[model samples]
Target: MINIFKIAARNLLRYKRRTLLTSLLITVGVVMVILFSGLSGSFKQMMIGLITDATLAQMQIHKKGYVSSIDTSPLNLNLGPKAYGKVRDMLEKNPLVESYSPRIKLGAMLSNYKETTNIRLNAIKPDSEIKVCPALPDRITFRDRESGQGLINPGEIIIPDKLAKGLKIKQGDTVVLVAHNKEGSVNGLNFTVAGVIESVAGPQGKEGYIHIKDARDLLRIDKPEVTEVAIRTRDFNRIDMLYAEINSALAEYKNPKGNPMFEIHTWEALSPFYNIARMIDLMAMSMKIIMIAIVLISILNVMMMSVYERIREIGTIAAIGTAPGKIMGLFLAEGFSLGLISTLFANAIGVGAIYILNIHKITFSFGRTENLLLSPSVNFNELIWVSAIVLLVSIFATIQPAYKASKMEPVDALRHV
Candidate 1:
């Protein structure tokens, strides 16, 4: 084995420039695959985290039929107080349950005293969002730094900064929320502007925030009813288990409505932005496959040229009684050596590049909203997998040239030169 490798190394050194060119091809392929996989994978994770932590949380439980008719933001389809309490109790007792926040989703008219426009509002508890969504408060741009988590109080609300700028409203200003009750009766209430936050996910989902009490009062709901419960888990990967537990624990409280009092949805189901992220992941895998194809073609070209140039040498060794299998092994070793060396260099370069990018906080916009931070993750197992595939493909590429060299007729070998 040592002798075979030494012979292969000698042969490669004889054609140093060709060998370097082949190795460089393999190196480029490896580096491209690693960088694409890392960037795409990180983008998917970042979008998921943004959606879950900022808006969706890991999961949500809504009244039956509520999500189906979500566009209407129907007030009649609400989880009455009894059902809300039951769900909250079930969430509290479960080990998988981290933190949950009850929200009343409402569509209302907003008036800055001079201008009125349509807006969506989420009425919530002032402090319940602490563990549930710590990022939510961290992203509150226009709030006083010390105001802390959740809505400030009744008659105070949070709006998106872009919307606030357009409406020409600011902190401590007054905004009026006018909405219709289930009976179609129009009701109006005034709220002080508490804070402004940047919108994540997209422009369409930008909304205002208010205390639940004010939402009920403005909408004229005689009793406490919630539209949905946004929930967060300590580990988002356990969402499946949490979903099952929620359904199992709430089985006793079934409603005639198709929604059955409460139904939970994972973040993926709640947001559509994930579809774009998934497409990026598919593109990454496709690029890696393309890299393998490039490796096969480039190595085959180099080995074929090497075999043709060394015809006399192959004939001499065959005439002296070298086995055909050994001849094949020599070429295979050459190809393998090139691939192995390239793989090492590529991995090192890829790792360093990712480190530099993350340290510098490299960012690019995924779609419309700008300022998404680049967070490449190292998948060492994937790196190993890619290297193995490249090496194997490189060896396979040598088969035709190696076979031709091994089968050269000894008598015809000395004829040409």
Candidate 2:
């Protein structure tokens, strides 16, 4: 083994350019995986925080089939007072249920009389919303008074700053919201602009927040129907635990219609941006595959050339009684050395690149919100995993070429011109 490594080292030194070029293919591949993984992870976390912390809680309970058509914000699919009461009791009984809030989501037209635009209306209880999203009240920049807060009363609406400027409306202004209820009847509500705020994450542009009672009145829902219940737990990391507990408890329970009452969703399921996150992951995987292909092709070509060039050398060694296994090990060692050398240096560069990017606080916008920092993040385990994969690929790529060199006839190779 020692002799094989020495021979491999000497051979690599003999063809410095080929060795470096071959190693570079592996290096480039490792660097891409490292940097892309870090950036993708950071983006995923940011999107999750924006959704779970800013808007939807960690989990939500919605009527079955609600998620498939969540875009329409269906009024006909809702939790009636009886079902709502039962679900609330179930949540209250569970120890992991840190807090929960009910909300009514609707698509409506908000008009300042001069300018009119469509808006997503989120009807929430100010008190409960604060518990789930503490930053909700703080996001309100403009209010009727210095001490004003979130949806203090019905007939009061909160609009985003972008919406406020676009419609030329501000705090204390009056607006009309026109919406259609489940009964297919159009209804209108007049509201006083209580505040203008900014969204923390998920979707951009104009949205409105109103008191739940007002939503009920405007939609003519007298029986206390709720579109969904947003749920938060003690720890996000342990959300799966709570989710399992809730599911187990509710497994045997059914609605009066003998159907599944509700479906549980993590923030990922509720947010469309989660698909974007998954796509980013797929892109990283594709990049890694491309890197592998580059390394595989480059190493295979170099190793094959080495076999052809050293045909006489192989015959001379075999005639001197060196084992065929030893000959194959020599070429494999060269490939392994190339992978090991490139991976170490490439990973080092990748780590440095991520650190610098995070240090500079690079950022870009998604929809309407601003100042989304592009912070790259990585971990030690992933670094080691990438290295191991590269090394294994190096060995696999050289196998056929090394075996061919080992099988060369001593007489035939020695007679080559």
Candidate 3:
């Protein structure tokens, strides 16, 4: 086996230019796959982190029909005091749940004395909200930084910066929020502007935050009713498993019709950005397929050329009693060596490129957020998988050419000038 590989290496070196070109092609393909996979994977993760950490959390639970009617912010669909108690208890007992925030979602009309506009509000307990969405506080601008105050206090609100700018409102300004209760009765309350919040989704997002107690008071809800529960888990990568477990646990709690009263969803289901993530994944897969095609074609073409150019040599070896399988193995070994060497160089170059990119710190904007950093990294498993695919494709590509050379008649080959 060693002698066979040594012979193969010598043969490849004899045609160094052709071998170099083939290896170069495969190396480029592998390198492209690695770099794209690393960069795009990093981008996807960063976007997901921004969305989840900013407001959405990794998972959420809502009344079964509430999400369908979410656009309306239906107060009637709220999880009542008793149901919320049950959910809170369940979450508290679950080790996987890092934190959970109960929010009272409301659609209200905001008036800055002279102007009135619609706004979506999430009323939350500041402490719990911060725990579930750690990035929530970072989004607040124009706050009393010296005081180290919470995101929102009772009788205070954090309006989106765009809304504040449009309304000519500033921090410490007074605003009126008018909303209707589940009973269809109108109520309004005065709130001090705590700060302006930077939009995460885009400029169109008009979500504002207020204290949960204030929301209950304005809506005249004596009982604790929550519109949704945003949850953060300890292991985000295993979120699907946690989602299933939570759903199964909640299944035991049914409504009068014996159907589950609650529904759980991951960040992907809650955010529209998931569509873009899917597109990125599709593009990554397409890149891998193209890499495969490049490796296969390049190896196949080079191996066929090798067999054609060395026909007389092959005939001489055949006449000297060299086994057909030995000749086939020689070609296969050459192809494998080419693939192995190219893959090694490609992995090294790809990793170095990724390292350099991280060192320089690539920054780009997503939606309204600016200067977000991209940290591209490829895992060991991904590198191994790519190498395996390239090597296997190279071997497969050489098989036909190898067989053709092995079957050449010694007499016929010697006759050819």
Which residue pairs show backbone clashes in model 3? none
Q: RMSD per prediction, one decimal?
A: 3.0, 3.7, 2.1
- TM-score between candidate 1 and the true structure: 0.88
lDDT of each: 0.82, 0.83, 0.90
Q: Tens-digit lDDT track for model 2 on 1-417?
A: 777788788998899998888777678888989998898888888777777766777888888778788779899888889878978999998888888999998888899988888989889988887777655665676644655543457988888788888889979999999999999899999999888877555642245789999999889898998988888898888998998887776665677788887888887766778789889989988987887788788888988999999899989987888788888898999888878788999988999999889889888877766778778887788798888888888899999999987898888889977
Model 1 lDDT-worst window of ten: 142-151
Predicted candidate 1 versus true structure: per-residue lDDT over 97-204, tens digit per residue: 878998888999999989998888888875775566667775566546364544468878888777799899999899988999889999998888888877776422
Clashes of 1: 1
What count of clashes does model 3 give? 0
Query: Could you tally the backbone clashes for each prediction?
Result: 1, 0, 0
TM-score of each: 0.88, 0.83, 0.94
- Model 1 residue runs over 4 Å out of place are 143-151, 240-254, 257-261, 315-323, 366-368, 403-417
lDDT of 3 by residue, 282-329 (tens): 998899899999999999999999999889998999999999999999
| Candidate that scores best on lDDT | 3
Give the local distance difference test score of model 2: 0.83
